[model samples]
Target chain A: MINVLVGSTVLPGNLEAVLEIYRELVARTRNEPGCVSYELLQLREDPCDLMLLECWLSQEHLDAHTRTPHFVEAIAQLEMLETAAPALIYTKSV
Target chain B: MINVLVGSTVLPGNLEAVLEIYRELVARTRNEPGCVSYELLQLREDPCDLMLLECWLSQEHLDAHTRTPHFVEAIAQLEMLETAAPALIYTKSV
Candidate 1:
């Protein structure tokens, strides 16, 4: 599996909006052919933070997902935050 | 500021062992002078997947944390995982 993990720190009040965007991202991602898993995680103590994870069968699917309209829009929204452009890492399964 | 994010897929049966170890990490991290925040988040859909997020006041603090005994212990434990050596990225706040 190829795992893409992203963490973004949002303005305290913008978390809800940010998550709403992710919900769309996840919903669409689940229908993609190589998507193994998609999840959104929140800090129990700090609700303002969010972690987004997407596991794919291959890098091809991940690249496709990034090209979608939802991702384009999502990337655009990054500028709306106090801090965005999440830390992204790709993990290759052992 | 510096953010270090790591995510690992634990063997279904080994999630407990992994998290128990992380508890020690978080406990010690909170006491470190430049540790701004530390959180362990699990995927709601895939509980075996874990994401570790650590925000430090600077890269200096992160380097110091890595030199500590607990982190060395954590590094050792990573070798125990079915999948380890998480994809690490250092994010600079923009």
Candidate 2:
């Protein structure tokens, strides 16, 4: 399986907007084929800090997710709310 | 529950050593009280990049984990093998 860790920092005053986007994106993404898990976590120390923990059956599955409407829309919305480019770490079980 | 995401980069030629430490650590940690899940993931693009996805029942449970012998030993060993200090994100389900 493929695992994706996405670290994002929301711009000042954009935390609620970012969370709304994530709520929709996560709900839609979880039902997609080959989605093992899709979770959104907010840092306890700083709510503006968000992390997405995603697991997919394979690289192909993850690629397909990126092309889905929910994923594409969420990224566009997040881009505006984010402080900078999100840090993405693609991995596999060790 | 409390979630902790740890990001680490291994020093040059220390991937094997780091993995050994994690193997032992994961095994021991899973058996600890209130450990809901503990996973180690290695980046697909860069093996040196590692991420730990951990879940515990509560803040107190996670605090107890850090004081455990296995955790303490693993941290000491990992500190020598890591390129720099690890990035830690303490979070809760959103």
Top TM-score hit: 2
Q: For residues A1-94, what per-residue lDDT tens digits would candidate 1 score against the true structure?
A: 5666666678877866777777787788789889987766664446566666567888788888889887788778765863655545454311
lDDT of each: 0.71, 0.82
Best by lDDT: 2
In candidate 1, stretches whose alpha carbon ends up further than 4 angstroms from where it belongs are A1-94, B85-87, B92-94
Candidate 2 differs from the real structure by a C-alpha RMSD in angstroms, to one decimal, of: 1.9
- Candidate 2 has what TM-score? 0.90
Query: Docking quality tier of candidate 2?
Result: medium
* Predictions' DockQ, in order: 0.05, 0.61
iRMSD (Å), candidate 2: 2.1
Runs with alpha carbons beyond 4 Å of true place in candidate 2 = A84-87, B84-87
Interface RMSD of each: 11.6, 2.1
TM-score of 1: 0.51
How well does candidate 1 score on lDDT at residue A84? Answer: 55
